[model samples]
Target chain A: MNVAALGAAELRNRLHGDGLVYRVGPYAVRLRSSIDQVLSAFSCLYADYPVEPDDGFADFHVYVHRPQNLRRWYRPQAIFEFDGKVPFKPLPFSQSYPFFEWGLNWCVSNHISNHLIIHSAVLENRGQAVVMPGNPGVGKSTLCAALMLRGWRLLTDELGMLSVDDCLFAPVPRPVSLKNNSIDLIANFAPEAVIGPRCEDTVKGTVAHVRAPADSVARAAEKATPRLVVLPQYVEGANAQLIPLSRPEAAMQIAGNTFNYSRLGLQGFATLTRMIDGCRCFEFRYSRLDDAIDTFEQLLVGGEG
Target chain B: MNSGTHRWSVLPDTVLHWYCADDETLVYYEQAGTTHLLTATSAEALRFLEYNEANIGELVAVVSQTLTLDVDGDDEFFFLMEALVEQLQKLGLIEACAH
Candidate 1:
């Protein structure tokens, strides 16, 4: 059963007691939280994620709760505990859900050694995945959310897990974490999108998450073939253009934006080069959402990208 | 002046893997876990050094002749040669060959 199948009282009861074990991509996460905000956020955003049995092998056993110190009565704060260790400093209690999201990202990005994890956004259509890796403020999440709204299946918004073994793209399909103005942009761009509660004044400014589409969640275990690797540059007022990159340059770009590429050594080098050699790489510059979405659609059907 | 006729050869073939794309030549040094995008001149220089032991002057001559650079008295050519040799040596991708 998925998260949407759980009753509100049952969800709360599970969270407050032993915790709810759920499947997120390949990992099973047992989340224990008495916090109402986290419960509401999970119910709304992770509604489609599959729920695991009560006693399964959970990769990450986590908690989001008050620090249980004097701060509980004061300006309460929430810390994310992963496998018995608090990995990040406490944020204001109001930011609990976002903290949970960030903590889970940390767990997966650091621990998933079997795949070449990258700091990227991935989406797919026509059985071809486009992996977008850019520095912060590159509008990766916004572009990903827009493309996803326009019929492209959202594979992932934060972590782009590429298989180092067989050169396949693993589908994490987690919620798209949109920050600041992008949140409003997504809301206005796709009013049908279900956005979770917005947390204000956190590290990445005001932030919110767009729930993964049901189709993406349902096909969560499917691995995708990366056909196009786009290094997106979101220049304001610039025309949408897809410029081709040489395979070597694309390989360098992938190495630069990766999370565990260097650590994996030559195995990573061979895997990345093989993947880039097969993918049609591009430097995508775009401003308008409509034009960007149109260009990708044309690329999908026309093979122009 | 930095050349000093010191012979250089590329690191072992097992440690270095080359991938040439449309516009770039990239090499990854597995031992150091580093990747480098080489210029045409740098690529030629490395290839020359890979199969044969050559000092900096020999490299400059071979690479300049291969790419047809104005090496007669060009300061840029000299600078490029010195910098390439320095970088390759620093990256541990090239070492002073035993005479």
Candidate 2:
């Protein structure tokens, strides 16, 4: 049964007790938290994800709870625990859901080294993937969310999981975190998109997460061969433009944006080289989502300049 | 010529990884963890020096033969070769061989 199948009280009981083990793409995550906001956020955003069997193994056991201290009564905060040990400082009690999301990203990026993990948003169309590597405030996630609402499937919003051997992109298909104005922009652009509760006044300004499309989550096992790598930057009032990049320039940008490029050493170098050799690379700048979407559609049809 | 006595060789103890696409090449220096983009002439120079150390005149001759540039009588070709050598040395990819 999926998380959506469970009644609200039963789901809360499972979370408060033995934790709710749920499937997230390739891994099973057991999340335990009594925070009403955390539970509510999960219910709304992750309702489509399957609930794992009671005996199944979880790749990560996570928890967000109120700590036993004076601060709980004063200015309440929530601490994130992984395998019974807290790995991060407590966040404001109001920000428990966002904290959980950030903690999960940290767990995956730090622990999973089998695939070359990149800090990028990955999307796919017709078995071809486009890897958009960018830093925060670059509108990477905003573009990713917009594409997912269009025809493209969302592979991942935060991490690009690439197979080291075949260079194929494995799908993670998690929620796309939309920050500040992008949240409202996406909501207006795709009125049907489901966005979770907004957490305001945190380090990243106001943040919200758009639920992964049901079709994308269902096809999470499928991998796409990378065909394009685009380094995207959002410039307000700028016309949407795509500039071709040489392989060497693309290599440097990919390496710079990669989360574990150096850790893989020589193997990483070989993998990145092969990936660059096989894909067309570009730098994309845009302000308008509709124009950007049109340009990408042209790209898919081999009509890009 | 005086150029014949100025020998050049790739720096010792440095592992280089290279990726070439048409006329452009990227060389990754493992020791420094840096990647340098090279033009066709510069790439040819480094590839020649990777296998054998050669003086300025010999490098120019080898690179010219590979690139089909008329360095035998072309003063401009000679000047370009010297500039490419200087560029490689500055990038720490090659060094002068002791006499």
Candidate 3:
């Protein structure tokens, strides 16, 4: 049964007790939260995600709630608890939903070692996956979301997962986070896109999440073969183009953007380089999403990306 | 500088891993757990020093030959050679020994 089948009241009831255990691709997470905004977010952003059996094993036990003591009465804040340890200080109570998203990302990146997790976005079209590694403000997530709207299957909007043994991308299709101008940009770009509640005055400016497409959520267990590794940049008003990046440089760039490269050591290096060697790498720059989509479309269709 | 007083050689093959693409090379130093991108010249220089501990002059000969540049007192080549050696040594991929 998906979360939507539970209805808001029953979902809220479960969250108040032993928690709602749900699968996020490769891992199962048991989430406990009583905050209203966070509760509503589950219905809006996570409606399509199926609910696992309550007694099933969960990889992470997380909580988002007001602190127990008098601090909760003061400036009303919500703290994230990961298996009873507070990983981060509280944000305003209104930001609980985004905080939950960020905290879950923290849990995945910090705890998992079986995969070479790079801070990237993964999308697939015609069975070929592309991993785009970029720093914040590079608009990789925006590009990823736009592609998904154009019929590409979104593997993830963050945390590109490549297995250490096989280097194949394990899909963890979660909501695409949008911020500032991107919120309006996506709204304008695709009027039919479903966006969640907006959290104002957050650290990353006004932020919201676009729900992952139902098709992507349904096929979360599918792994993808990487064929293109891209370093994306949003250059204002520039023509969208895919510039060829040398294999050595591509390896370095991917290594630099990785979250657990040092922890994985030589195994990580071998995995990253093998993927780079097998794939066609590029440094992609664009201003308009339409042009970007066209450029990617041409690459996929012409077989010369 | 008194760089000529010491001989430099690459670390043993066991401690270093090399990946070549086109004219560029990426080397991973196992001890330092770091990867480095090297130019064709640096690759040639390291290739020469991998077999024999040589001073800067010998390294310049191999690297210049690989680049097909004249080594007849060309200041630019010498400067680039010295800089490349400095970079390789900094990465712990190469070290200087007493001649």
Top-scoring candidate (DockQ) = 1
TM-score of 3: 0.95
- Candidate-wise lDDT, in order: 0.88, 0.88, 0.89
lDDT of candidate 3 over A1-305, digit per residue (tens): 99999998889988988899998789999999988889888789889998999999999999999988887888789999999999898898889999999999999999999999999999999988999998989999899989999999999999999999898999999999999999999999999999999999999989999999999999999999888888999999999988998989998999998889988989988998888877888999999999999989887775544
In model 1, pairs of residues that clash are none
Docking class of 2: acceptable
Q: Residues A22-53, candidate 2: write the lDDT tens digits.
A: 98777899999989999999999988888998
> What part of the reference interface contacts, as a 0 to 1 fraction, does candidate 2 reproduce?
0.28
lDDT of 2 by residue, B44-92 (tens): 9899988789877787788889988766777787777788888888888
Candidate topping TM-score: 3
TM-score of each: 0.93, 0.91, 0.95
**Tens-digit lDDT track of model 1 for A153-186:** 8889989999888898888998999999999999
